[model samples]
Target: MGIFKKPPLRGGKRNAGVPDDLWTKCQCGELIHTLDLKQHAYVCAHCNHHFLLPGRDRIELLTDAGSFEEMDHGLYSANPLGFANYERKTADLREKTGLNDAVISGRATIDSFPVTLAVMDFKYFAGSMGSVVGEKITRAIETATREKRAVIIVSASSGARMQEGMLSLMQMAKTCGALSRHQEAALPYISILTHPTTGGVTASFATIGDINLAEPGCMIGFAGPRVIKETTHQDLPKGFQTAEFMVEHGLVDAIVDRTKMRTKLAELLSYLMPQPSLSGQETLG
Candidate 1:
């Protein structure tokens, strides 16, 4: 042998020069790997940036382990007008995202306090609200009322689903109607807005919550920035429609980072509906 080459020492250790495949640094200066970030509840470690979470992932993060009971799991979209490619698009999106629709609705507990949660997944056609989405959300609210549980909604969307045409636009009114019922029940409805909440979703149920919370740097508005600027011929303020701007303008209650969301929500729920004692009185009393 030619002095038996030991794989050139492999950079002094086995696999020593191989780059790690898991970890990545976000633009916000946060060091996170996939699994580690998931373990942190999809929050960036260094900057506490709230990563855009899937609807199901949000439920997993907020709900008590194994406590979530999905409502309306089988509901799906229908192409009433036989619009060309609409059905195929819906089917493809369902397969790609593994979601029945843009919204996921269910009943669960946060910190052991019963609540109903609905989250929108932007991956599902940019989270455009359609008839099925509106129906599912309304039904979820009804279920929560029957169970006497608080309702929480996490909104992340581009707008109404244009593919569904008028049916999609109808969701705006329907969802708002459902939220009105929640108000009538005196049940607290908390809305947490993520990045790019706009269009009919923002115009309706997204803003109807009793307490509105938004993630930092999230854009919450009914219209696109350019469209508004072009319409009014005025310069939009710096950070317009940002979470901080919403807070300053009294639109959003607070700007919460992802890391503290659970704790904050628990506190809010506690304040809204404190636990009852054995005598049917609040312990805080």
Candidate 2:
């Protein structure tokens, strides 16, 4: 047989795509280096579009260094509805995202304040709120209640996982129920809404936070604009179902930037949660 060689990649030196491990485009047509994106917390410096952030990275961004101790790390999804290839698909996602489920629940400190943190990974099946995800979140909230720690849930999801049927939908109520108890104990819960928070998540624990915060331009609603328009035969208003609009209308507490999220959370925690006294004489009152 004659010796042959494989063809070289496009552009002579690299792949043809924009973000070929080197470059990406902003919404304003600005060329951004992939390294620049990481340095900027994945926010576009030109137009400031908030990009999808990975769950583990978000945990690192929000939590104190060496402070994250993950809980329920071994839990995986089960095919309660017997969806074809669901287990196989979930296993693949587990390997791909390096997460046991869509949500990563752990005990972490933000600015040295203890918190129960749960971050959802959108790369895993759109971060669907399936059985395991629901269980993990509920357990996180319950643990926070027990520890008298603040609960911070960063929600990014497509809503209930249809593959699990009613089992998935039940999570909406289950998480909320746990949260209701958490609230009764007077603990603070800060829900961070990233891009594309909708469906049951928007209607449930995600929205009922003591202070609901969202990133700029995050899409938040029960149903997306297109789905609502198609179902109701109505024209959606400008900027409808967005974090910007929600803040203006008082649905969301504030539209926070990704860069300032930790600072804002720490500030808010200072206000909502009382810090422990440092000196013994302070109790003289």
TM-scores of the models, in the order given: 0.86, 0.90
Which candidate tops TM-score? 2
Q: Tell me the spans in candidate 1 whose CA falls farther than 4 Å from its real position.
A: 1-25, 29-31, 274-285
Clashing pairs in 2: none
Give the alpha carbon lDDT tens digit for every residue of 175-232 in model 2: 9999999999999999999988988888888899989999999899988777789999
As a TM-score, model 1 comes out at 0.86
Task: Please report the TM-score between candidate 2 and the true structure.
Answer: 0.90
lDDT of 1 at 161: 85
Worst 10 residues of 2 by lDDT: 276-285
True lDDT of residue 124, candidate 2: 93
Q: After superposition, how far is residue 282 of candidate 2 from its true place, in Å?
A: 18
